[model samples]
Target: MVNWFWKRKRPLTRTLRVRSRGDYGDVRRVDFAELAPEIDTYLGQAAYLQLGFFETLSDLIAPTPELSQKESLSLAAGAALLKHRALVDVIRERGDDPLDVMLPFREPLDTFRRATHGARPLETMLSVQITAGMLDDFYLALSASYGATGKQVAEILQADDDRDALVSILKDAIDSDPEWSSLLALWGRRLVGDTLLIARAALGSQALDEEEEARVDPVFTDLLGAHSRRMAQLGLDA
Candidate 1:
């Protein structure tokens, strides 16, 4: 979680904060005092202009799944932050295929980008951590409901000494909520755990926090259900 990055010039000729994050909530703390100009500079780039693509994606989502558009956007925004922020160096260190690893949730992402993101560029959107928090809350609820219990779900929040024990405590969060979980067809494995990995990083990064239990955003659940349904058409195991 280092915060010292080699300041490479941006292709867009914009200056965005190249944050060096640590394991603690140690990202370059939200420094509004020093950020306005930098954020504006990043937003001024052509990449920012491409955010209109999300509007088109929004239309593609139709009524926008079971989650409210806001909720979906929250989740999507989290996903974006994970990609752009989070434990980025480790991901890069692994030399993992970003497309294969992260883009599995493309449908939802594309839908989210189209619906939200407006004229903000990716660099600008990801520079701030508050937005990542919004997304973190959205991801925890969405991922846990898929039937992963507390023990399996513990990493979403704290770092437990006995991860196995904490996972046991987390079963409720993963098991009882059928709202979003019902839409997911859990088999023996996941074709897309990286989506959740992004969320875990967001949670650890303090970019997300949990909402009250029983707060099931129906719009999101329905959308997830729709996402699950469509997967069946391709004969892909849900």
Candidate 2:
């Protein structure tokens, strides 16, 4: 991932408006400097992240006892897989091997997945909902920097994730046990820092100067706003 943020300070005026599409209604206009990873890096990370989401959701299916819940999770998993394939196709169109592009990110992202995983199934489900939602919004914002490829990536991400079913399942769990409300809320809060780190890392920088922070803040602010709504919808306080 090449650093797109030049160290020199400059007054930031660039803005990217992420239009609401499909079930991606929460994405909004955000102002940020022109910052993005290299196209291969962007496509690789985005592609693998979707694959991770699919794997996490699919893993949950076998342990899930309810047939309806299994089917719902399956749908969401399938959506993630479809997005992954779409992204990989884009990589191929660019003449890059998907595996090579994605390889460099595998370990760090896998570590991230393990860190976000929960001891219980419901908690893990919330992890997926909150984390995936935040990262998707982040990618949508970053997609604007890549021109035609960005548009293609944005379209793939905007497709209905079918995660609403997971939300319903979570709501049912909370309704049955009020305790879930607090537990999941706590887990959701814990996810923010880690997810934000991943978002920042995607910018290919480990640290940002004050000017850089100012430029990047609005994008993160929008991400958090959308994140809070997602938590609230699931009856969890973020």
Candidate 3:
């Protein structure tokens, strides 16, 4: 298990603009030196995280009884695997062995996967949608720091996740049983802490000094805002 620690300081009122090129064909960019990691660190973590999502989604397929649902899960799983492979190509183009770059992150991220896995399949499905959405946004924000390579990564992250099926599946679950509405909502809320910790940890530190925190705060704020919108889209309270 990954031990989690978070400290809340008073929010700072500031506007930081990040131009995102890959999301919805928007070609804008911003660089954050204080929060960005070395290029290898960023690439390795992003690649492995996508691979992890693929593995989780793949695991969900067999036990799922409905053929149409299985097909939907396969699409989402394939998208995740495609993103993972695309990231690996980026790593290879840099002349680094993909495994060498990705190895260090395996244990911690696997721990993160386990920690976020839920008691039921629906809870786990929401975990993939929410965590993947937030982290994909986080990495896209960090992509600007790496210039052209970052742009390529941004494009990869922005690819269609085909996770809308998961959303419809969840919404149906909630609508079918009023009980699922509260259960999944609570699961969604519980996910934020662990998910944020994974995002924070990817910055190459378990702890950040106050100055670093200040610079990183707005990016995370944006992540949380996107997260809430995703939860609401599922008809659940964030």
What lDDT tens digits, residue by residue, belong to model 3 across residues 81-127?
A: 99999999999999999999899888878888998898889999999
Best by lDDT: 2
Q: State the lDDT at 5 in candidate 1.
A: 16
In candidate 2, which residue pairs get closer than 3 Å at backbone N, Cα or C atoms, i.e. clash? none
**Top model number, TM-score:** 2
lDDT for model 1, please. Answer: 0.28
> How much lDDT does candidate 2 score?
0.83
**Candidate 2 error regions (>4 Å):** 1-34
TM-score, candidate 1, is 0.22
Tens digits of per-residue lDDT for model 1 on 1-238?
1121112122222111112112222112221211112211221111121222223333323533434443544444344333333223223344644334443334434443333332322111221122222233233233232232221322332221121221222233235654323322332013223233332222222222234111222323332343344334223234
lDDT of 1 at 120: 28
Model 1 regions lying over 4 Å from their true place: 1-86, 92-95, 117-133, 140-238
Per-residue error at 95 for model 2, in Å? 0.7
* Ranking of all candidate structures by their TM-score, best first: 2, 3, 1
RMSD of 1: 19.2
